[model samples]
Target: MTTLTPAFFAQFDQDRLTAADQAHYMHGYHVFDEHREQGALNIAAAEGAYIYDTAGNRYLDAVGGMWCTNIGLGREEMAQAIADQVRQLAYSNPFSDMANVTAIELCEKLASLAPGDLDHVFLTTGGSTAVDTAYRLIQFYQNSRGKPAKKHVIARHGAYHGSTYLTMSIGNKAADRAPEFDFLRDKIHHVSCPHPYRAPEGMSEADFLDFLVAEFEDKILSLGAERVAAFFAEPIMGSGGVIIPPRGYHKRMWEVCQLHDVLYVSDEVVTSFGRLGKFFASEELFGVQPDIITTAKGLTSGYLPLGACIFSERIWQVIGEPGKGRCFTHGFTYSGHPVSCASALKNIEIIERENLLAHVEDVGAYLEQRLQTLAGLPLVGDVRCQRLMACVEFVADKRSKALFPEALNIGEKIHRRAQAKGLLVRPIVHLNVMSPALTITHAQVDEIVETLRSCILETAAELQRSGQYAGH
Candidate 1:
């Protein structure tokens, strides 16, 4: 409704193009009715930490292009690398004994970088496929190990793995539920989310930690350890409100998985590639070396569609065993596509050569600190974050920490307000999630925080004027 007149859109008949878009191109996870009425922002271009809408609006992309774009945008080097690979070999059949150099090199680098002995890499199209592949690999491994009954998988209630059928089943997020879509509920189970802030009213952090671990173990037992095959988790629960679980939660859960002989799959689609100032947060921040790590997004820095399912030596010894005549018949056609592998290699090169990880370590802490200063604001109930990844949960009553009614669309209100003032954040229910580029400077972090502060304040004023909020 702001009206778009971007240079690119000018070349075409704007009304006709807009009509074409509305008639076709159904978007993902979008409300079609609302979209048809409000239209869309044509993100024309991007550079560094900011994106330009067709309406000539430049906003700092605090969502980091949906939790990817680690090395930031419009990198000529990335473009060159991808183009070079395309001219050389665009597609590589990964079936049978066929191989490609780029993918092979990528595998070697990934193995060297991955924690522990997670050396085997199964490349896929995106995070969903990568996680789906991991699930299938778990099924194949458990069955090959003669434990055909171990088909059950355990995941946390708020955790998000992916959108694929198998990954959706493992992910117990609100969107991945029954009625709307069928899932493998009989084979997959969920325990409570390990969010400290949302723990029972009287439960202390220590008590919450104990409860989570005990509940996890109890869930495994309830499913019968012999029937439980694996447990899936995101290190920081990215889509589930940027949740940083209680201290020592991952390690304790890993211990439980070890005791029950259940494999731990760390889904690092959003956490890896410098988002947390580490390649992977499983072992560095959480003290757990998972048997498998499903990663994408920043693997190629979102320059290309690529995902990898990293497997440990223990499982590979079973799945990759010689001459069993049992073909691990699960694979994707685009697995290890030469261009994606090349992009990932170059992305890793840029991350290392520029020392973006170290940069993130310094500036990420600064961003979190600046964001925490917003806790005094009227609508802010919680400012939970880890390094560059963050979430600001809003509430009608800060004292009681009571959420605004879902119909109020508090997150969307703040998001629109911020976008109008040159900032962008992902609206997840009642929270606004942020994951800026690793290249963002400390000054930019200050700008993001200050602009966001004004947005929240402005929205609170509007809501109060309308009698929707009783200020804290």
Candidate 2:
């Protein structure tokens, strides 16, 4: 064991975090120690759609704090709600029929806001747990209905559910799961991704939609519908490059699920809570009533971690039946954490009181229109948007839509350029952006687009200088 001095512990403090200290103590997703040694931008404060680093540099948070922060940051109401809850009841055990008032209230509110018969809620700490819990519940439901062999899960390629073992197995992001996670459970199957931008060469949008639907049905048939437990999907794929499925794609998938008796699970972790101008995007935006909906991130607007798996009455009727002598046998210690629930309650109130959903709907259209302007850039292969969530795919050839060499790290280059220009956008492989906060205004949208344009131009120039840009 290494001996630690008081000074060494002090170095780990946020206020005293230095480049060396960060390299020693902190590591983030897909980041190496060398990158951390170069130093990280320490955010000291945030308000509305912007965040200020410790260096006093203000940045327009284009990704909305990992697509959470739906109502934006630095809300006094959210802070007060959390503080008040902490003082009154900071923790509670949600097991054994025990519950907290705030948790109950949040559940009730969520149930009322959810679509169709999805009125039952099981709270968790965040998106991953919500997804894990849903997967477990699906198994339990299957077993309860005398179908224990129905243990297989079907997910789409390029879908991002979460990070837990089960969720990661369900997700099809090859980069997210690699060398270390090579032994994932074999119960999950991945179908073709329904991305219009990368559709087959000669396939029309309608033909692509039909192809995707047929692929889903064929996968179900291959797995033997009775052996497949559920189909997991994100309303609009978040971390898997914000992939937006073609119109009516979700409805067709849901129909396949219904015909096969396989449960349809909507993983709306990023799209819920006004991100897509709706409480839940499954039924409202996609015209599909999922048997279960998993949500997090925006639930508390990143003020606190909270997630929920809402069950439809159709399934709840079987699983929640009285005297069944069945226990869920799964729950997180912080499943119904009081402070998180309180924060979520306040967050929901703010979204409703301010009519932020409508605001997102109006501004989202303008944002999409503004984003279309980026299509004029040579590097921009595709510009796709659904409400406030959008993505810009960069390619070496706009006509051929060929991706840049992976070694070039072109997406990271543009991300760094944008960050230096006081803007933050997510880099999903070959450049993809998601600005989900409802607080982003049309003016901010213009700023984001302009910053992206400059960053793309700078990246292209650098690529050209390096002889990496092949003229189409």
Candidate 3:
């Protein structure tokens, strides 16, 4: 498919823009004016895996718009589907006894596509809400079964669930969560994540997995497993530095959850809908049949905000059973919004019809092979990938695997340099995570790798020149 081109370049000066933006806008994942003051590269438009800036600069979108837009941009079919739905029934509340046609149809489609007994869905506005809703569902399910003490949620360190109060507790990235308010006390517990690269020296993958599982078991026991509601995890940690767990990690965790009879909540928010070469990442990668699944991001491929907490029949029977004044006791005004549903229906169709999963497997393999070239670089410590998702961790000493000090901001500098060179990739703390559109071509991968190579080299040179590249 041919990518789109803008008619003309946008011309806007940043000095004048910062005053107003700083006064009004609150940016997420950014230091706001401190970063904006340096410059905000205004994106004029986007199509396929490329975005054009106000200055007419064209860049490869390596991160796929925060790792969401899986099908790429300029998808007329999805946009038109949304438009059609809006015209047909733009707004509707799925509260209590109400629902639109699109919502109903999308639910059926999702049920057919989801794995195992995950046939029922509770829709939400986006990923965070879906996560929040899952927590509520787990609690509600336990209550229905006459267990009121199962209110605590167990998550893992280095996991990024969401930013909502409940989800922030489940999320492990301390930086993502604000200082706890009085209301947030005693809400969540965390276990060590299984990242062999960050594991203790001489620890094998099996040892790491065993250690994490033991830690999880200890935490659950200490917290009183009867008081624990669910265990939340991403198939491969996304925003939390893209830390992929060792093999058999999830298998062991799933066994532990089963042993304790705790609900297993897999956060497929960043890995669902062909993003990981499957409809769901947990089943495809780890053989997990979660009691509930929290997902968003690729559901509508960024065309519209949509998320869902998919429950197994057992969970649905507990939550969705018909009774007077008895339901999940949760929903959003925009839950199962007609337009969003239509967009998702169309997006999923595109993914299947185009065989995007197979494409992801192919292009994803290409991406991994190309990325391995980066492993030997002076600043590279480890490279990770499981399909469309990939990341490179930077360290000051590869032999010792010692990270560059946070003060150096090596990752952010590399990100900025890549942006200057017309490449858009995300730097998560000390790693660069790339989640390009599943439809990206081989040429696009080459462009991304070449740009990244240049940026790393330049950043290394600058640091060395400044005496910051503390060597072996």
State TM-scores per candidate: 0.97, 0.95, 0.95
Report the Cα RMSD per candidate: 2.5, 4.6, 2.1
- Per-residue alpha-carbon lDDT of model 1 for 261-329, expressed as tens digits? 999999999999899999888999899999999999999989899999999999999977888887878
Listed per model in order, the count of residue pairs whose N, CA or C atoms clash below 3 Å is 0, 0, 0
lDDT for each candidate structure: 0.90, 0.86, 0.84
- Extract clashing residue pairs from model 3: none
Q: Which regions of candidate 2 are displaced past 4 Å?
A: 1-16, 20-24, 33-37
Question: How accurate locally is residue 142 in candidate 2, as Cα lDDT from 0 to 100?
Answer: 90
Candidate 2: which pairs clash? Answer: none
What global local distance difference test value does model 3 have? 0.84
- What is candidate 2's lDDT per residue for 1-472, written digit by digit as tens? 1223444334344546664556465544746644554667767668788887655568899889988988888877777889999999999899987999999999999999999889899999999999998998998899888899999998988888888777887898867867766536688888899899899999999999999889889988988987998999998988888789888999999999999998999999998998889988989889999999999999999988899999989888888789988888898899999999999999999999999999998999999899999998968888988888999989999888988888777788899888999999988779768765798888899999899999888888877888889655
Tell me the lDDT of model 2 at 229. 89
